[model samples]
Target: MRNGLSVDVEDWFQVGAFERTIDRADWPALESRVEANCDAVLQIFADAGVTGTFFTLGWVAERFPALIKRIVAAGHELASHGYDHKRVFTLTAEEFAADLEKSRAILEDLGGVPVRGYRAPSFSIDARTPWAHPILAEQGYAYSSSVAPVVHDHYGWPQSPRTAWRPLSDSDLVEWPVATAHVAGRTLAAGGGGFMRLLPYRFTRWAIARMNEEGHPAILYFHPWEIDPGQPRVADAPLKSKIRHYSGLAAMAGKLKKLLDEFDWTRADALVPAQQERARPWRAAA
Candidate 1:
């Protein structure tokens, strides 16, 4: 079972946790650490002899074209994390389409790779944004890893399937959602940034192992900023947001290493193809 490994490439100041405290216009003044952090991430996978997808921000790609080239050169899939970190639900349909085209064009030109995959910033595509996946398919996105099956306060569509499925009836574009596993009849997020950081590593490993043994590839994701402990902290942010963003920064690298060593991991592009037999039709609305 070759599971999916992904990196949501964005700088520390750009994450949603700091949305209220950090202004997007002030982004240029922030000490940008994404390029160096991404290099570290690439090295981790290189040392482990693994390949995965990098769902890169267009903001990052436009500034660091060389970094985009490095990602492509390293044999990783270069996918979109949107033009900025705007959540799908927040954007009107037209805004969403424009953002999509702008991001795909920038990424493909810089990376020299067809940017076929997308992971919405903050995983914000839910029932509210019923048109999200269909628009992605229309824009030439072969797939999206945007849906997280577990419902949380921020974003989710829990009724969706656990396996890769075509959300639009007419298109082949698949929604390869973040993985989850059932525990006592409840769905728990098997893997992703916050869960991987906040939960005990043993639980994540157990969840992934259980999911894999049950014949599903566990799709795990993280961000470049997650590993940077020295990142500038948002001092005035709410305590919960501060804790969620900063508490586990120092330990994320080691956990990623363990995942690489213990589990069979592959790029989403490679993993999605094999999931077709398991793919079913998923409704955009409940």
Candidate 2:
């Protein structure tokens, strides 16, 4: 029951409030940062002998074909992350569908791979928009890692099943929620955003290992910005954003390397084989 890893490919400035400030016109400079950041991650994976899924924003794929090509060439799974980083709940079905198609087509063209998986920006899929699951299935996405089952001010579906499950909303879209730490009847999120940054590495390893024991492989995800301490700071960023994005940046790479060394990890798509039975119902859901 090896765990899985996924990286959401985006620049540091394009996150949260900065999204409002950093216009599409500013993307060229952002692309340079994206390259250096992703290069470091590629090196990290190479050193650890680990492979991971990279859910890239369509904006990045369209602008950086070479980067997308390099990711696929390196034997990692390529997946869509919507056209821009727009929240799914914020978009109408038509808008969401268009974005999904746009992102999928761009990724397929650039990566030269069957981009079967997707992850909502900011992990924003929740009960507020169950429509997203079916839309993803309709768009031919085979799996999703967008549900974070813990409560958060921004995005979380606390009552959502922690283990991978086929939502009634979509048979073809297997919902892979982020890893969590179950303690004394409470489920604590283990990885992603601030949780990955602030939490100790041992705790994450133990939580993920415990999840594997329960027959659910952990899915750990992060962004390139999380490892870049020198990233430009957003002015008047929300207190929560400060904590979630910048808390432990300097330590992230080392912690990530330790995690790679200690755990049995592989790309999310690799788990598709072992999770075939679990995901089979999803195929019908589509």
Each model's C-alpha lDDT? 0.89, 0.82
Question: How much is 101 displaced in model 2, in angstroms?
Answer: 0.3
What is candidate 2's lDDT per residue for 21-130, written digit by digit as tens? 56767767653577779989999999899999999999888877899999999999999888889988898888889999999999998888899989999888887786
How close is every model to the real structure, measured as TM-score?
Answer: 0.97, 0.91
Each candidate's number of clashing pairs is 0, 6
Q: TM-score winner among the candidates?
A: 1
Q: What is the C-alpha RMSD of each candidate to the true structure, in Å?
A: 1.1, 3.0
lDDT of 1: 0.89
- Residue pair clashes in candidate 2: 171-282, 171-285, 171-286, 172-282, 172-285, 172-286
Point out where model 2 deviates above 4 Å.
Answer: 20-32, 279-286
lDDT of 2 at 231: 84
lDDT over C-alpha atoms for residue 254 of model 1: 95
- What's model 1's lDDT at 107? 96
